[model samples]
Target: MVSPVTVVKCEGPKLVPFFKATCVYFVLWLPSSSPSWFSALIKCLPIFCLWVFLLAHGVNFLVSRCGAKRIFAGLIFSALGDAFLIWQEQGYFEYGLLMFAITHILYSSAFGMKPLDLKAGVVMGLISSFLYTLLYAYLSSPFTYLVGVYTALIAFMGWRAIAGVQLCNDLWTWTKLSACIGSLLFIVSDLTLAVNKFCFPVPYSRAIIMATYYAAQMLIALSAVECRDENEYKKKIKVT
Candidate 1:
């Protein structure tokens, strides 16, 4: 017979399988149920918990510790914007857009502060402005307008990143590349959301949009981790 301690050790791996089974059952049962307040609350509970985890652990703790103070603040603002967007009652969308616009600006500033290249900025600005105008013409929503502004900011920052490749003396290329990829994913997710909101009524639209959005957010968090790792590597090199 196995000792009690050995039995407990053997059962540990089973816990994950049991938890996954429970979650699967709960999710499957959720949409078929009656329309009650508690039912709605239960349906949204997982997403609410995810939002809290992203804010508290992913953005606040991880990014703050990674030496990206301004970016962390911007992410907090973006999380607030996400909350406002999810509420979906009243005219909170506009406020959410404003908050997110500020977030994009903060992120742009954080990334672009060192480059100081006016020519690149102007070129990116012109291209982004034209794209924004085209998207606005097609979309005609306040959310689209906000996305336009955010796109322009991203373009500016992206240009800075490209230009600064030569100037990255500390050789944190991987971190920078990860950040660039994360930014691109974020743009793709935003564009997908805009399409979903304004253009076509695709099936499983919410699922697709949320999946992309969450993935983009997670990529951004990974960029923060990359930054932290790069910083530590540089510190180690200096000490050696």
Candidate 2:
């Protein structure tokens, strides 16, 4: 039998701070004020807390070592990206796009391309192509190229995240599924944001975008954690 210490390591309690911070942001911060650096920091507090939890947690296990570092970096970038977008200061849009593009690249790399799932890739490509085509006329010169690259990066990230589901067999299945769903939600959130910003105004667009974005980040972060089987986890906690 696995030792109690090992069990505790593998079956540690989840990060509660993330959820608490998320609730506080949506309830107290999202609609309170105009765009500012402070608002952005408030918006990204949950993600920042998640990053801290990953670093400080007792668990030594990880779904993937390479993935862990990449996702952590991605979280940092994501927070920076949020700050730019939320502030919406002069030239901040481009900076936001740049940060988010890097975030997607890191996420895609961490998700890995082990199975070579062409089907998922093709689907992501088709969707991104369609969206870009739709947004083409509205995009100005610099934004045209910037948005295009960002779209491609996000699509690649989504493809990798969805394709990773195939790697799941036992304990990792939930995490795989979590990532898959998270990626899809990220796409939805971005799609809504793009439409509202470039194409036309979307009613309640801010709420929709932030809602999906937060959930996507949360789930993706959770998926990176090392998961244990139910009975095994129970025993581990019992021992602890």
Candidate 3:
């Protein structure tokens, strides 16, 4: 099992230029639905911003560990997924899907197989199975197999993230907590996207998708922060 997390000084994420650029779409400041380079850039700005921030954070502060590097790699793929997905109408859906699958694989690698919690596995499996069952009829040929594989990967990612919690160890650090929550949010965002794309169109689907996706990316990015241990933090508080 991976050791319980220890941090140096946990400073949270700083809002980024790319993240700020994406806000306009969510707020309907630019409501264009057309496919264009500018639109794709805006759609993917959040992930780009997070990647740069993670790199900077890792260099300037804590989280220079293996986990942070894997997370950084995942963000790179995630940004590519966003870019490819914006051109989904022009037939890049599968490529986008592939990129995200790699992203999750890297994320799961970062979380590691700690505590080997069956409870987390079961929960993730049931949810993934339910989603696949719901969309089975709509999936045809290769997409059927592809989506199934993607679901399993995501479930495993979720399982690994949850297992990192180590509730028994009483090591509920910000990194673990944010990573857990971020993984779940990533699942939720993907679930909504899959349902909307294959089953039926969700009203305001783009907004919903981008909102959850950005939030998930943000949290995962912040998970790279390394901070003082709980006792150490408390001790400093007492001193102050």
Per-model TM-score versus the true fold: 0.58, 0.86, 0.85
Q: Determine which window of 10 residues in candidate 3 has minimal summed lDDT.
A: 1-10
For model 2, what is the alpha-carbon lDDT of residue 202? 99
Q: How accurate locally is residue 145 in candidate 1, as Cα lDDT from 0 to 100?
A: 59
For lDDT, the strongest prediction is 2
Error of 2 at 101 (Å): 0.7
Residue-by-residue lDDT tens digits, candidate 3, 139-185: 99889999999999998998988887877778666678788999999
Q: Pick the candidate with the highest TM-score.
A: 2
Q: Which stretches of candidate 1 lie over 4 Å from their true place?
A: 1-67, 116-127, 139-148, 161-172, 202-204, 225-240
Q: Which ranges in model 2 have alpha carbons more than 4 Å from their true place?
A: 1-13, 30-33, 58-64, 167-172, 228-232
- Residues 65-134, candidate 2, lDDT per residue (tens digit)? 7687788889999999988887564667888888889989998888888767898899889989998999
**Candidate 3 C-alpha RMSD relative to the actual structure:** 4.5
lDDT (Cα) of model 2 = 0.79
RMSD of model 2 against the true structure: 4.2
Per-prediction RMSD in angstroms?
10.0, 4.2, 4.5
Per-residue lDDT, model 2, residue 137, is 92
Query: For model 1, where is the 10-residue window of minimal lDDT?
Result: 1-10
